[model samples]
Target: MMFRQLFDHASCTYTYLIADPVINAAILVDPVLEQVDRDLKLLDELGLTLQFCLETHIHADHVTGTGKLRDIAGCLGIVPQGAQASCADRYIQDLELLELGKVIIQALATPGHTDNHMAYMVNGNLILTGDALLIRGCGRTDFQGGDAGTLYDTITQRLFTLPDTTLVYPGHDYRGFTASTIGEEKQWNLRIVGRDRDSFVQFMSHLDLPDPKKMMEAIPANEECGRVSVVV
Candidate 1:
């Protein structure tokens, strides 16, 4: 198993690369459009063939590199079946398993931040949580059909059920913190650690976070697989 975590400072987004050493095949999760060159360089340096460019959800911050990667590298673009990312070549459902040589990536339909959000569990040990579960705070559920109660369920009922030692790699983090264990989050994530549904809802309701600055542009481009403008 080979893995690398790449970061986009502008949006605080984290992109993940995981490959099967035996076959030299790789998958990228939550790719950013502007970073396509860097990702490709890394893949080439490692002598890996790009098999899939996966999206955890349609992002509102940074446009996705799925289409470009596919066009240039001849890889498939995959997203959650309900993401409505019309430009993607394939959409996967909950529990669907994607194989890269010997590595298996399992989809977990844990919606909340966005109604179609999906987290990938790799080999039952590492979880690429996207926006669903963060280190000390989870994603906000105030837009894109977000529901606090549903998010609460996804966290307490689904993610927390994972093995305590499962390594959690979140999609974004504002602070310098990087990587956390399920057990640590269970104990320290103030937003959902000990709060009940109602309390969590109340807390999230008052957050009042401003929408991402790039939301207007990024969301549309992401849905269209990074086409900044559609040609009629």
Candidate 2:
């Protein structure tokens, strides 16, 4: 298995490339629209055929590259089962496994940041927590059907139950930190460490974060699987 983490500075998004070198097949997770060329080049240089472009959820920050990548590479577009992506070629359900050679990706429904968000666990040891859990902080539960209590339950009940050593690679990272382990976060993540459900919900309600800068344009485009014409 081959894995690479790519970053988009503009939106602070993290796009992951996971592949099975034996079969030369790759899947891009939470890709950014502006980084399509870069991702394509990387895939080409790696001698891999892109078999899937997967989204964790319908994003409200950056438009996805799935649609364009699908058009260019003829790969299927996959999204979480309840994501409002009409153009997705497939909707992956909870605990469903997507395999390429020996690599297996399992979809875990961790809906709180968004009503239909998902986190992908790869090979049982690594997790791609798409906005569900961050390094120290978690995603804001203020919009897109977000609920603070639900997010708390997801972190404590679902994700925290994983092996303490499981690697956590988040969808976006504003801080310079790259990755963290489930044990580290479980012990140090201030957002969920000692807070109960009600307290966590109350705390999240007071964050008062502003919407993402691209929210106005990103949501609708993401719903269409990143198909939109820019007026440039």
Residue 213 in model 1: lDDT: 87
Taking the tens digit of each residue's C-alpha lDDT, what string does model 2 give over 51-99?
9998988999999999899999999999999788878899999999999
Give the top-scoring candidate (lDDT). 2
**Candidate 2 to truth, TM:** 0.98
- Model 1 error, position 165 (Å): 0.7
What is the TM-score of each predicted model, taking all chains together?
A: 0.97, 0.98
- Poorest 10 consecutive residues by lDDT, candidate 1: 223-232
lDDT of 1: 0.91
Candidate 2: residue 172 Cα off by (Å): 0.6
User: In candidate 1, what are the lDDT values of residues 1-232, reduced to their tens digit?
Assistant: 9999999998999999999988999999998888999999999999999999999998888888888899899999999988878788899999999988789999999999999999999988999999999889999988877889999999999999999999999999999878999999999999986788999999999998999988998888988988776321
Find the 10 residues in a row with the least total lDDT in model 2: 223-232
Best by TM-score: 2
Alpha-carbon lDDT of model 2: 0.94
Enumerate residue pairs that collide in model 1.
none
Question: Model 2: residues >4 Å from true position, as ranges?
Answer: none
Off by over 4 Å in 1: 229-232
